[model samples]
Target chain A: MVMSWIWTGIVLLSILCAAATGKGGQLSSAAMQGAQAGVTLAVSMAGAICLWSGVGKLMAVCGITGALSRRMRPLLVRLFPSAAADVSLAGDLSANICANLLGLGNAATPMGIRAAKRMVRGDIATDELCRLVVLNTASIQLIPTNVAAVRSAFGCTAPFDILPAVWITSALSAGLGVMAAYLLGKVRRG
Target chain B: MTDYIVPILLFLAAAMALRRKENAYDVMLQGASEGLKLLVSILPALILLLTAVYMLRASGAMELLSQGLRPLFALLGIPPETAMLVLVRPLSGSAALAVGADLMAQYGVDSQVGRTAAVMLGSTETTFYTISVYFGAAGIRKTRYAIPAALFADLVGFCMASLTTRLFFPE
Candidate 1:
């Protein structure tokens, strides 16, 4: 709640400053348009994500996800050693991570939730949950559909300009995240 | 109407295909039933983040923030205009990309600034928006290091983008 209040204050401060400096009024029309545009974009994104989740679910029901999971299990197990063998929460987490990297957050979020729920059902330790959280946060994405979608939403012809940069940064961040998670796993009070 | 035809047709076809399959419907229902709480939790955070961004852009604070950071920009081979681009991109991704393209077209993509802008475009995440939304959705009460960590990652991204461009696209 404190953070929420602080955030609110910052918004008010930015608005007030913009208005006084005349930039606020200058861009009043554009800002209004932007708000409309932002809403449209957000809604579209939400819809797109929902669609993807549906497709993913279809894939799962058809045994596609399981098939893919089986193929990926070896590599996935290495990535998430603590996860139970075959048909485990860690495997689901890896699928979610994969989806997130592809910029399917909507789809990935569900998978992630499922994974977390499964982990909880398995009575996974808090430490593993935290590690999964870190991994999710640090999940290295390649396509960055959300970012690219945002770029396209704004009308850029070349959304992939940021691809290389995203790749490098995410890879490093994920590497660091995994290391940190591993270290924390070793030392956490839990 | 014609311009929208392709997307419309694609969706219709996909829907038709899905309708023929029973499994698709079940999977959709199962996943949709969850994550609603997380989505609800973060709505306020988004509203607040947007308000803050609006305020910063309004008060001329970002301009000041930009001006103060010019020297650092120059050191990284970043064009002055990119300050505005980076500042705006997170709030509105398309606007930032447009700015980057304009800079490239104006200065030639081979120019240091143009390339830097390109790299910048790819490298950084929408910091404030992302932090607000993700943290909000997850009900993450404490973001002890997420902000700093993300920004630090952005900084690293900025540096790497420039470095890689120079190495690969060397003049």
Candidate 2:
């Protein structure tokens, strides 16, 4: 698959570059250090993912997700016309977007996967599925917590001063992403 | 206010489930277990990707590439120093954060380059990671146009971030 090729290429390129730059030791250390970081990241993310996923499941069981679907139905229909009739899919998609908008990237993944599962038709990704993925990829963050945290850590007087900039860029990116996906989908079908 | 949103949502969702007689504890436990499973399933690929990313950075390959790309990025209104962050961002979130933090530390946080890096981080997603995980979960094989579209979006985000920072934070 393409992912495999990309991974292989990255490793090979890294090795080649390290040798060329005489940074072989750094590359070795990076291999071990990066793996450690990966595990640390996974562990740190697990608790939040568990909590959100649990809450998401509870919402589904309590019909809260269904209500959300109904409330978001109109917008969801416009965004994903094919999934409009499938309430569960629409609900999952809505929850994913809601989480992303809130800057809960970890919480958004499971719902996004569920929505994609519901929309995917076999091996081929439908236009709706592609659009859903695109939307998630370029999600507009209402609160960019990580950026703010980094700014504050660096002793910035106002970490959120970049709010307006983030808002404009994120919104524009998401909008353009959706439009691009729509257009590309048409071309792919043709 | 932003920090409380997730906790508040969790509390409300739990309370609502409990009120609905949904056996909230059991359902939550099940979902949490499922989450753990998902984490385990994606660990290998995540580790591989992160390792390559870190190796590339530590080996100075990323810097070299960024140096090579500096002219073009400068033409695009992005600071030459931020080329690495922009390139690594869509591939890995933590890596991008590291680069952004470094940029902020090197250049004062209020500097145009620092602000641009922050805005870029805030606006863009880890496209490759997200696509892989979502598609892997959905058991889809052909990504087709998804990657290109997402990368294009990220490009737009990068440009917009640079432009907005210039406008709002005037260097």
Candidate 3:
């Protein structure tokens, strides 16, 4: 797939650049350090994902997700017309969006996967699937907790000072993404 | 203020579950276990992507690429230093945060470049990671237009981040 080529190209290019720059020694160390960093990142993310996923399940068990899905159904239908009739798909999509809106990217993945699985119509991705991916990719983060946390950690006096900018950019990106997907879907169909 | 949203929502969800008389503890355990499984499933891809990203940065390849792309980024109104963060934003979230933090430290946190990087980081999602996890879970081979569309959105985000930073945080 495209990802394979991208991975290979990055690794190859890293080695090539290091050799060209006479930093081969540094490159070797970087490779090891990079792998170690990856493990640490994953382990850190695991805790957040576990807690949120558990919370998500509790929401479902208590019918909170169902009520949320119902409240969101009209908007979901507009966004994903193909998935309108499927209640579970709507529920999953709503839950995914809710998590994403809260800036819970790690927590949102499981629900996103579940929604995507339901929307896949065989080997090819359905229009709904593509839309969902696009939406998730450009999701508007009302909280943007990670970015704010980083800014605060870096000693920014007003970590959330960029909220307006974040709102504008995210809204534009998500709006354009949905538009692009819809147009692409039309092109693909025709 | 934004930092408390997640904890508040978590508390509300827990309170609701308890009031509903649903065995919240058992359901939570099941979901937590499922989450652990999901984490294990996606770890390989995540690690591979992260390692590649880190290696690219550590090898100075990213800097070279950013320098090479500086002119084009400048033409688009983005600070030359942010070219690397913009490119890396869609690939990995933590990596982008590292780059953003580095920028903030190098330039004063209130500097235009710093604010721009912050907005860019806040607005964008980890596009490649999302695709891999969602599509991998669904067992879909063909991504169709999702990648291109997502990248397009990221591009818009980058532009808007720069533009808004200039407008709202004028130098």
Candidate 4:
């Protein structure tokens, strides 16, 4: 992919620069530090996500997911007509998405995958699946918790300057994503 | 310094409270395990980034970039060193952090470069990192236009931060 090529080029260039500068030794030293920091960051984020996911699991067990599902059923039914009105997958998707907005991508991903699997495990038609894909792709996360957390870790004083821009970007991206998915579905149908 | 501590502690407390009847510690450990896996996956990239940063610092490529960008920085009323941070910040935040620290050490933290570096650090996202992780996770194989779009947003942030900081604290 083009992204792969760009990443490769950047890596090669950095390596070349490193070798040419005769600072290889120093680089290794700094690399250790960098790796350590990355570990800490990954742990913190993953921990937060897991904690939330655990709570979500509890809510589901307590029938909260079902209660919420009843309320969200109308909207979800409209979103995926191919899906059965009584399925738990719709509720799961909704709940997963709710967690994702709160900045829990790790938790959201598994929940989404489970929901998607449930929705499609039966003999659903291909067109409906495509629609579900579009909806999932267009799932707009209003507050980017991961981005905000990273900014805070980096010593950003306000940490919310890009809130306006990110929200706009997310909305536009979601809209385009949905449109693209719909077009892909339509093309296949045609 | 003290101000930052409160928010982090509050966050930790809230994360703990989310446990309710369940064991918060166990959940956090599960999260940590997942985080550790992510860390391991990206360890190679981090190593490369750190090395690249060290080489850049020692060989003075950062200085060269700063020199090249000095005029532009002047027009924007920012220090030349700030430009290097702008480019580096997105590529590798750790390296950028090291550079920022070095700059702060060289010049007082209250200096123009120091303040701009701080603002730049605060305002911008790690563009390459975010793009790589998000798009990669989503299985987005092509970023023909996305890279430019993200970087363009980063440019806007950098310019805005510099201008805003300068306007408020004209030095």
Residue A66 Cα positional deviation in candidate 2, in Å, after optimal superposition: 2.6
- When just chain B is superposed on the true chain B, each candidate scores a TM-score of 0.70, 0.94, 0.92, 0.72
Q: Model 1 over residues B1-171: C-alpha lDDT tens digits?
A: 334643553354346546666544565655444344444444555544554555566567777778888888878765566777766755545556666777676666656667677666655546555545544444455454444445555555566666676665577
Weakest 10 consecutive residues, lDDT, candidate 2 chain B? Answer: B40-49
Best by TM-score: 2
If both were scored by lDDT, which would come out higher, candidate 2 or candidate 3? Answer: 2
Off by over 4 Å in 2: none
The numbered model that scores best in DockQ is 2
Candidate 4 lDDT, tens digit per residue, B121-164? 64454556654444333344433344544454555556665666
Q: Is candidate 2 or candidate 4 better by TM-score?
A: 2
Residue A174, candidate 2: alpha-carbon lDDT: 89
Which ten contiguous residues of candidate 1 chain A have the minimum total lDDT? A119-128
Q: Which pairs of residues have clashing backbones in candidate 4? A: none
What DockQ results do all the predictions give, each relative to the true complex? 0.26, 0.74, 0.72, 0.13
True contacts kept of each: 0.19, 0.79, 0.77, 0.08
Clashing pairs in 2: none
Where does model 4 exceed 4 Å of error? A11-190, B1-60, B75-77
Any runs in candidate 3 off by more than 4 Å, and if so which?
Answer: B1-3
